[model samples]
Target: MAAQKNAGDKDTEEKKKEKVLRRPPEEEIIIRGGKGASIRRKEIGPESEVPSGTGKVAGGNAPANGEALAVHKEVAVKVDHLSMKFNLSQEKLDSLKEWFIKFLKRDIKYDEFWALKDINFTLYKGERLGILGLNGAGKSTLLKAIAGVYKPTEGSVYRKGVLAPLLELGAGFDMQYTARENIYLYGAVLGYSKEFIDSKFDEIIKFSELQKFIDVPLKNYSSGMKTRLGFAICTAVDPDILILDEVLSVGDAKFRKKSEKKITSMFSSDVTVLFVSHSLAQVRRICDKAMILDHGKLLAYGDVEEIADRYEEMTEK
Candidate 1:
């Protein structure tokens, strides 16, 4: 009887151990497609320690491997320790007397917010890098920094080739001007020669599928039409380095498909692409490597599938 009791107790303990080792099924959530896939929230194992003297991250610290160094040899764009900060301010309403007093002192109250901090990465010719992060994670800020629209508060960016950023389409477009006139205006902003713009004018109009409205004022066109025209004109100029934000998501499905094909073709060519998108599937399809940013810091940078898995894990939280 004593032996039997001991055996039963051992069995119970073994069963408990087995249950503790088991993990629950991961829940799937679809963003924009077929059956939603479950987010993988598994902790990643440590990668092999790369040798020293390889490359560097933000703040001028060398990376574990020569990843950035190797890319710099082949590509023209190198971002090093890029950071941006914005000042937040609010007006204080005091008594009229207090306000007058403060006005005499010329004192102001404000708080500083870091929009991007210590962002470091490298891009090579013909490499497509995808940037993934939630809103306010500094996606747009990074692009603007690379485009030279916002100078980094810290660190520096190095560009070896001409960069054409499709950030804000029609950013320089004159609403009152006809598409023909805006073509010259927008083309010049993108670094195109007048002759080049003249040569590509018909092609741009044709690709936009807005030839019928090409002579009309840009303000007269619908939003979709405007987006199509803008995209066509911007992308028509062949660029060595292209930065694409979520702007491609503006057009209709047919136009979107066409734009996708155009982008794929560009990817196949020598053009280096820095793409920012929330669509993991699209990112996986186009990018060979991806980087995840959270609160202005890089969480991971590596193979697209691996990074995507890590990103999904993070979202599950």
Candidate 2:
């Protein structure tokens, strides 16, 4: 019996030694190239200069001891109980003479219109949100509010870092100037310095593929050319937050494809985005989350794919 016990103990010792000879502490099994590869170093986080790992949902600030909490280091946008109000004239005057007479008498009447009411949402850094709604459903109003085009009638909006809004095609452009001159002018309007625009000049012109018409006056340029130029300049700067509102639908298919590629590339980067599009497929393809609004009211706000499903149901009825 003693000999049998000794043999069993020796067998256990050999197994322990074999275990120690296996994989080292420095090497970890990670899936790479469709197979597990031993990696020696920790993967970098999303906000890192060189991203090597997926982004963790950063937790909230100031947690009690032993308490688990979500805390992100930064917030791109926070909309708190926001509302937008506009007054539309109930009656139209026939001529300027009649309008002046009514204005002098203080008799112009309007109906109260609330484009947005008590809308609230928070956008985190490096998060992409898609806004879904039918026409006149206040999607544009919400985006415009965030873009600072329209002031909120109620609540407040807080934001950090530079905002690059592509709300309209050629909004700040000078039609009289040549496309080359307009590049600098529009860049300055977008808050870029002359030197900065100078540096991005070649890249912008190359992406727009408008080298031959660079010196042509912008007014003579077709809508597609204008859109291409505008898109190139806006995307040149790696903006902290980007707001796009149906801007891509204007250009031709090829230009649209190029624009889509640029946007998709930005999605991989650390850029917070607010996108409004009628295409549900595009929303699902790009957005991390989605929000649905109907007649100035928020219907649903959650995962992109789920929201797409709900939106389809809502619209079908």
lDDT of 1 at 308: 88
Q: Compared with the true structure, what per-residue lDDT tens digits does model 1 show for residues 28-84?
A: 111111133122121111211122222443323223345554524443456766778
| For model 2, the run of ten residues with the poorest summed lDDT | 23-32
How displaced is residue 177 in candidate 2, in Å? 0.5
| lDDT (tens digit, per residue) of candidate 2 on 81-164 | 778878998888879999999999999998999888787676667878899998998988888777666767776555554567
Best by lDDT: 2
Give the C-alpha lDDT of model 2. Answer: 0.71
lDDT values for all models: 0.68, 0.71
Residue pairs in collision within model 2: 58-71, 59-70, 59-71, 59-72, 60-70, 60-71
- Where does model 1 exceed 4 Å of error? 1-72, 92-103
Instruction: Please list the residue runs of candidate 2 whose C-alpha ends up more than 4 Å from where it truly belongs after superposition.
Output: 1-70, 92-97
